[model samples]
Target: MTVTEAEGDTAAQAPMGSSSYSRFDTDWLSDATLALFATGGTSPLFATSSTVEVRYLGTQATREASLSFQGPALFDTRSGCNFATALVDEFCLIDSIGTARTLGDLATGTTLDFTLTAQPQPLGSPIDQRASAESFSSLASARWIDLGGGQYLLGFEEGNDASYNDMVFLVSGATATLPSPALPVPELPTGWLLAAGLAALAWRHHTRR
Candidate 1:
């Protein structure tokens, strides 16, 4: 495996260097996409970073969203400098047909294709051991949930936190990008990344204690 493709530790998952979205593709929130134009995509969100999960999907009666993050760097806000290690923004294409919103939650038939670009550390060293208060640029992620038979919502959240409650998301039925994305963010994992889109259906709701 190439140096970039290798998996790193967690602590760096959350912006604050916590352990949340640090699992492999099978993990709850650790989603990796290759770069589009970069000829090669980088694992921007790889390693010790924390990720969040919703105990309830868009199908959960739209009540208080059952969301939770188990580490630092977890975010939830409109905008602000994030615990992200890089200063790059991500891109995605919605393929359904709801409100044509930029980002939000996902519904049963709702689908979106997004990409991420990991900024390589100076010496490839793990970051945020202590999760310094050094606020850099803000990072964001969007998702679409399947609320049972054809129901959907698109959700987008900025900043990093450990709360997935009542956080508004997008409605589904919006025509989004294709599952087998023609382009990736960093430009790696051509086959596997595309597989991820197809496998997104396996995610089970995460209930926080």
Candidate 2:
């Protein structure tokens, strides 16, 4: 099926750092929603079941982002599932804001690989840009936030802005099999270390005196 705008009269607003021509209009998500899920943790996600449900949460992107999926360990065979035919091939589930769609039940043990294709601009010679969770080279393009209870919040950064709020989705029956980004270790500055060393030497000299 083709992607179409959701029903309802909605107003469009330009996302931050985007031109007027690029507008997103939807109410399913807001800044608070993004903040709530921002710290939920991120990692490469997989479908726990063949029957996965997806809901278009919202978008804050300049380009038109569409959702699709391929499955049964097609992207990463090392994920461990037996080789099976792709459950879905580039199906357009959501192409606009506030739309929700579900994929038909797939074979059990099928690991899902989600993709988001950025449609070409209406006025320019831009070509379709695609990003997938299976592509480790550009893993930053897609992020999966575990929402717990077999649900997840998937977001895509369709452009260089790195605002994953571009195309947000609420997915059910998914889990993160990979580790999330770890917090950086804290370390003292070189000046602090030098001062500590000098203080220790002074203390020793005082004791000897």
Candidate 3:
């Protein structure tokens, strides 16, 4: 069973430092949906076109601009360029050890794209170690993007594996009330039965009149 930390386990509870240097973490945010498919033994493969929006609630400390959240945990793992930052907007982080890096220099779009070959040195080191299973597996292929407006939509699925490709845009907005167990929605036809019947009744009454 792939165990997760207790509910209260977060950057808030750890003895972390200001946004100064890079800090490694075992936990990075994965789409709650992905966590389900990629359970302890089952790794969910992100398809091309699978996108999600994320929100970042700013953090402050002692009235100083202390960067919060586990930034490097996600920033270091950018296999094949897994994320992008918007133009005019840059990806910045102050690690627990006071390592600060920006993604603005890496991408050329309002939003950047992922290219395994086009990764930054500092950003690539942690990811490499993780993927090799030589370091914190958490850092392996797991870097966070600067979700614009504090949120982003990340889509990169293309029919199961990496064969049939589409741009899974990492757009932002929309939160799943419950992230686990990807929720199902009623098909349009199935859900419209009542509305369709109501419309039919009104039409019949009008004809009778």
Candidate 4:
């Protein structure tokens, strides 16, 4: 479950400044095979054609992974390391909605594997917290690799749960378009407040795709 995100199979490159970054525009048809699995629930994992942007912030020396799609809510709680930018090649945010929403750094092999962990909560509880339950349950595990040249290999188990663990799904696709890194990154809208948790998308419901 090791994923490598880098430029060719060479030394890693850092974004010269805040403006330098890499943008990937997804091609749906190339990945239309996403329908071969079941996706929907509290953690709706998707390999469909969505906008994915990755960039390195020179000031922080950390990379950002952004995924924006028009669909139902997928992620809820985000847990891992806090915002200090010290750890390398480890889980940072299971889900994020801020500028540094991605997992990985300026170095190679930073974007490793992704796992889905969840625990049931007692009803009528007024609070929702991460790891509150002593026995945390593992829902699924996936392996993703960055094949360079704006291409990626994502393999995961669909409908993975206590009942299903025998199915695995894999997908690959090249970006339809890329963005010029010379331009400055856009700013988030004013007052776009995020919850206290690490930045992950706050999605609204949509019709099944």
lDDT of each: 0.24, 0.49, 0.25, 0.26
Q: Write the per-residue lDDT of candidate 3 for residues 29-99, one digit (tens) a residue.
A: 32342323222211222211223222112211111111112232222221211222111222333122112
Most accurate candidate by lDDT: 2
Please give the RMSD of candidate 2 to the true structure: 16.8
TM-score, one value per model: 0.19, 0.50, 0.19, 0.23
Tens-place lDDT digits, model 1, residues 1-209: 10111122221112111322111112222222211111221112111111112211111011111222222221222122222312232211111111121222333232223221122223222432232222222123444443433233333332233222112232223333322333555766779888886666445323321
How much does each candidate deviate from the true structure in C-alpha RMSD?
A: 24.8, 16.8, 16.6, 26.2
Off by over 4 Å in 1: 1-140, 162-167, 174-209
In candidate 3, how many Å is residue 113 off?
Answer: 2.3
Instruction: Give one clash count per candidate, in the order shown.
Output: 81, 0, 41, 6
CA shift at 30, candidate 2, in angstroms? Answer: 2.4
- List, residue by residue over 168-205, the lDDT tens digit for candidate 4: 11223323233223568887755554441223333322
Over 160-185, each residue of candidate 2 has an lDDT whose tens digit, in order, gives 65556556677777677732445799
- Once superposed on the true structure, which residue ranges of model 3 sit more than 4 Å away at CA? 1-26, 30-100, 105-109, 118-148, 153-209
**Range of the 10 consecutive residues with the lowest summed lDDT in candidate 3:** 59-68
